[model samples]
Target: MEGKKKIVIGLLGESGSGKDTVAEYLREKHGAKLMRFADPLKEILHIFFDKISREDQQWLALQLRERFGRDIFPKALKRRIENESGIIVVNGIRFWEDYDFIEGFDPGYVIYVTADQKVRWERSSKRGEKSDDGADFKRFQELEQSETEVHIPEIGEKAGFIIRNEKDLNFLLEETDRIMNEIANK
Candidate 1:
């Protein structure tokens, strides 16, 4: 641990699982460093492929992985976080590739947040992301399930802690704080 920079907390969960909110809370409350997988993809797509549709952006993401292999983004993000200190939260982790890539660094903790399906849809609808297009339930489910082809449990089982994000924000925050303390004490 002499050469290790700081503790990293990787949060993996399904869409609308409030991962972003939890990450923000951690940054605000714990003064943790943060990196999100979507930021790089969004920046690259906007700069190089202007006027691309959301669907096309998604397709391009898949193509980028196919071309560079899945770990490119995760490795790049990890490099960006290497100099940081204190707790760091990695958001937007998707595939098992992403998980395994981060696991290589041996993060101090991995937390998987989950919510009820109906709550997830409602939250996603209001989250202001592409998934929040106010579409029908079936359409939304198809779109969401397609984006998250793998099951959350597959990743959650790998997490050191799990938080259900259905209650009030303060309640969720309290639970997150408790879990953070629990992990830090280990």
Candidate 2:
């Protein structure tokens, strides 16, 4: 019998959609490696800036995409993990270009996690990340609009599986486990 092939799972979602939670679950339960396309930008910010604000990170990410191309970060990540073995859970896939680029690689699955806006807003507020610290409902909407400019909704549509993360942690974990099993069996 042939051995199970390595798989790459690309996570797509808006802010507070539980992509990180899913990735962490995959890592802890299934021994998958967690990687994010934002790592490069974060590394650059760490080197040059004393204190990198959320706006700075967003600006740098956008500038990098605009200057280098929409697929720049995804391509870099692909190259970085090319020789790896086993499951790789990639978080923070926002654009169709990112989807297409990663999909071109072998044995990849794109999973879109979705939650209602009100639920997401509450979660984001409770998390209180520096970027989301002072965002009111109007500000949240504005930020979400800017985020949508990257074509996240279209990317979500392109996903192989859409996981609605509206319920509790147990439900999310069960759903993630089911998806992982399906991917492994494919």
Best by TM-score: 2
Model 1 lDDT-worst window of ten: 49-58
The Cα local distance difference test for each model comes to 0.74, 0.80
Q: Candidate 1 on 1-186: residue-level lDDT in tens? A: 224458778888776788888999998988877888767677777786644444555576688888998776787786677778767788877777777766666555778888877787787777565623466667667765655445566788887789989998888899899997886666
How high is each candidate's TM-score?
Answer: 0.86, 0.90
For each candidate, how many residue pairs have backbone atoms clashing (under 3 Å)? 0, 0
Which one is best on lDDT? 2
Model 2 Cα displacement at 142 (Å)? Answer: 0.5
Output the TM-score of candidate 2.
Answer: 0.90
